[model samples]
Target: MQQLLAVAIRDILPNKVRLAITRLCFFFNAICSKVLDPVKFDDLENEAVIILCQLEMYFPPAFFDIMVHLIVHLVREIKCCGPVYLRWMYPVERYMKILKGYTKNLHRPEASIVERYIAEEAVEFCSEYIKKAKPVGLPESRHDDRVGGKGSRGLHVITPSVEDLLQAHLYVLNNSNEVLPYIVQHQHLVKQSNPKMSKNWVLKNHNKTFSDWFKDKIFADENVSETLRKLAHGPKRNVITWQGYDINKYSFYTKPMLTVNSKHIR
Candidate 1:
């Protein structure tokens, strides 16, 4: 259902309708994650309600009745006791199905369940007492032939290719523009150490060489000024709070502004 809604909003639906509905669903999912504080929850609830009402006004009444009721109640429930998962019946429903599967005799299901459960528990307890004993229902030899050797674990480790290493190094350099001068100095030092070293070799080992040189610079306190420059520059805010109003020319106008603090903006 979540994936369907996401696909509809992101790909299928038009932007005018999709933007509003997507924002509402995004907040709903965020609330479900149970990470939001009271202030943030309140903000989300307000935005959700506004968006829901706008959607109801634009769409047919029949389309919203049940959904609106559920959304309102969900918001209220979240406000009262955090996320929905805390009070949801999904885990209980799963366990109930498991218990139902254990029944043998439909007429005397309770008795059958109790007997089977007790016998299973006893067998499990006894199995634990035996050294290197496998579980009761499992096969005696459970070796996974797909993994090749008997002792080999079925784990695939990924190693980055030379091109991947080069790309990663370039990405770091591009983002951290301040590191260029230091890299140039390091290259000069490398050239002095190995006069015959080719530019191709330096390019290939750029990431490793830069990392080693950077570490040395830190330990020797050579780039204290550069470090301080980096420390002084704070992280940029990615979020913008917008206030919408009706204009004469434009039906709706939204003015974007930065929030006072990160806590107030999602």
Candidate 2:
């Protein structure tokens, strides 16, 4: 019931973009999701061009909005900016709703908001000083032990963490395709180091940390390593270079034309 209400409110909101632009954004998001390496730049560019073409096709005849012009330069914007979220207002707007809820009194709304905010901050500060007190504004069930229990429908599967991936043998077996021959040679090296170790034991223990212990270990190319290193660090910032309108460009000056037949007009 709660989820349905939330969905209805979200759908009914006046914040929606045009259907064509929404579809284009969805495609762009799909491309971004699969970008694990720098090699996917060509694919990203192609998707961006498709979106620009879509914007041109679905452009309204009467409206010459700034957003439409921005859509045309989406590719350049993405190149300058990191991702869509950084440039999007959805998160900011959602937070604004929370801020709006802070207002209580009609006569002195600003004072009420400030008072509520200070009270919240004081409670949070007090929670830190109190022994074993749950953090203010957090639900009592937030850290409940029964969260992922048998009857609970919560997600229970635990994927390997970054530290685990750096130290796990199973990760190497699954991702060894990138450096297959090197992995095989590394297995031999592991065996030499611990001849009595069982295959299961070796598989669970061999990792990048173990590789570092070996004097001669197979490593990825410096460029590939650097690219992977950057991927691990994640996007830095959401900076976009706003494209300026060229006065001479056909799209900038020309308005969509509508023709009426004389016989139909009469």
Winner by lDDT? 1
Model 1 has an lDDT value of: 0.63
> What TM-score do all the candidates reach, one by one?
0.46, 0.35
The lDDT values for all models are: 0.63, 0.53
TM for candidate 1 is: 0.46
Q: What lDDT score goes with residue 154 in model 1?
A: 25
Q: Which stretches of candidate 2 lie over 4 Å from their true place?
A: 1-23, 30-59, 86-88, 106-108, 131-266
Instruction: Report the C-alpha displacement of residue 110, candidate 1, in angstroms.
Output: 4.9
Q: Give the C-alpha miss distance for residue 175 in model 1, angstroms.
A: 27
10 residues in a row with least lDDT, candidate 1:
148-157
The TM-score of predicted model 2 comes to 0.35
Per-candidate count of clashing residue pairs (backbone under 3 Å): 0, 0
Candidate 2, 1-266: lDDT as tens digits: 32234344555434433544555555555434534334655675676566666656655655646765564465556567756556678789998887779998889988988899899999989877894766689556423443331212222334545555444443443364555555666677778889999997776566543444321332333445543433333332332221222222111222233583321210
